[model samples]
Target: MENYFIESNAYNPWYNLAVEKYLADYVQKEEVILYLWQNQNTVVIGQNQNALRECRVQLLEAEGGYLARRSTGGGAVYQDLGNLCFTFVASEERYDVEEQLKIVMKACQKYGICSHFSGRNDLLTDDNRKFSGSAFSMTSRGKVQHGTLMINVDVNKLQRYLTPTQEKLKAKGIASVSSRVCNLQELNTGLTVDGMRAALRAAFEEQYGRCTELSLDMLNNDKIQEYYKMYSSWDWRYGRSPECETVYSHRFTWGEVEVNLKLHNLIISECKVYSDTLEVQFPNMLEGLLLNQRYDIQNIQIPEFHKADEELAKQLKETIMWFSGVWR
Candidate 1:
């Protein structure tokens, strides 16, 4: 087939995401795959993002939502049944984001809604309220460009699952970028997901000739199941991010201190400290001191200051104290 579509029957994020990776792993040169799927109560984080810093894993898990980490390098996003997901998988040389986005914009046009591709990876209305955000990943096999389509998505659950930290935005050098989203259904009450799916298929065919609709059963197999296990594993979802994204950074008269923590069950499973102090080894020293400690202000064990570095140590303590109070 020249163009094809695959709609998942699974709702589990792990399974859906596993299929996503599977498609990326085996992109055919002759055909481009348009995958439409959904995940229920899930928060997907970027590959380089710190998981703990990006998502409230404990709270989300407690509430029966999943935390998934994609292979792409981008910020976190929420997914549910009310949301529709789409991916365009093609060869590296044939891949094009602008052309792929046309399928989305064209689909919206059918609903009598004018949408614009705004910012880095979002499609917004004329007034600038976004209804979709997208992310990308390139594999050895091919390239995958995927995004969310908000029809009647639950925004309340999104707020609870995602606990974005300023450190992440600040570190990624995109602190000023801001976005607001509105469901497509909010703009047109008569619109349904089925209608959108039909529109998307027509647009996709218009852009890529004809497409074959592959049965979900044909796509389910041992290879996808293996990837599913990797996605569902604790290590994959809750593991360290961007060299530990849970960062506490501040500046003092001595220098700047940025502490990164990887917390497991409220304890510091891993720790790394970065400082621009004159003492090159000071940050390394703080890492060891903070490692294995509980993530609490009272539990922070301040080290004894060497006579020559006493002034720097005082400022370090002040920085820690400040982050401890505000990092809630």
Candidate 2:
């Protein structure tokens, strides 16, 4: 058995993971995987999930520099220095995701952490506080099973960073930032994130095979660049939401902005912004600018208007700037 490890000491969450995904996506089937815990903060969204719906944009942007939308379907998960992430990349012909998860579970059991698989992909403690969540992406070369292991994370920050989920609210009743969360340190008082990562690495190596160090790729490629564009853009993140709906509205200066909109899968299907600002000729200039394109917004082009007059164009630019200022 051959193993490879990508040690990212410091990097943005999305890029670091993307680097791993890109390289792992093409590596040989005999490859096994191990990655050390990194300090960068990140929000990893399920592949089919809308980035915007999974997290609070204002909060995430303020704390975590970038958000990553994965190519697998699951709920959003928060990761930081306090978290230890691991991945198992094996040839699909010889590997099983469930067995890979068991390899991780054995590691947790060593620390007296009674863990069990929850629902489709979560690994929860005996008391039911989730400590690990798993997701998989398959390539012709193989399949990768990746998940996060909580060691001593700031639960408060986790809540503050993630968007509210009705599913979470209904099931756990721990919605929003104010909720119950625990770390291994709180439970055992001896395990650190680094220690946990190292222990897991040893366990995986024993189970999968020998491990080797792999150099990190820093250059931009088409596939990685595309992932960055898709992940960073608001449309791909929020517009693809499955829970939220689109919002539309128009009104005079004093009255309500009577919003009329269509929301599907928590994403804006269509939107129109209107306001009687009277300062610009095209008060509805944002009509074509979607109020909610979410993930698919990256593919849409900003509308073009054929205004020939130089003075009119300048005036329009000023008005547009002013209009944006009001919203800001």
Best by lDDT: 1
lDDT (C-alpha, whole model) for all candidates: 0.78, 0.60
Please identify model 1 stretches exceeding 4 Å from their true place. 164-177, 244-328
TM-score, predicted candidate 1 vs. hidden true structure: 0.73
**What would you estimate as the lDDT of candidate 2?**
0.60
In model 2, what is the error at residue 22, expressed in angstroms? Answer: 2.2
TM of each candidate vs. truth:
0.73, 0.72
lDDT of 1 by residue, 1-328 (tens): 4688988887898898889898889888766889998888998887766665666666777778888877776678888888999989988777889999999999999988898887677899988998888888888888999899999988888876675545542233121234688999988888898899889999999998988888888666999989999988766775434333366777777788887777654457787887888878777777776777755445777777779878657766776677655443
- After the best TM-score superposition of candidate 2, give how far the Cα of residue 104 lies from its true spot, in angstroms: 1.8
TM-score top scorer? 1
Worst 10 residues of 1 by lDDT: 169-178
Clashing pairs in 1: none
lDDT of 1: 0.78
Tens-digit per-residue lDDT, 1-328, candidate 2: 5677666665566555666666666667566666654535677777676554456644566653466666666677777788887777666665687777887877777777777777757777778787777777888778777788788777776776674433211111112222234577766778887667667776776777777777655435778766656656555554455544433333433332323345564344665554444434343444444455432333334444466544434434443343332211
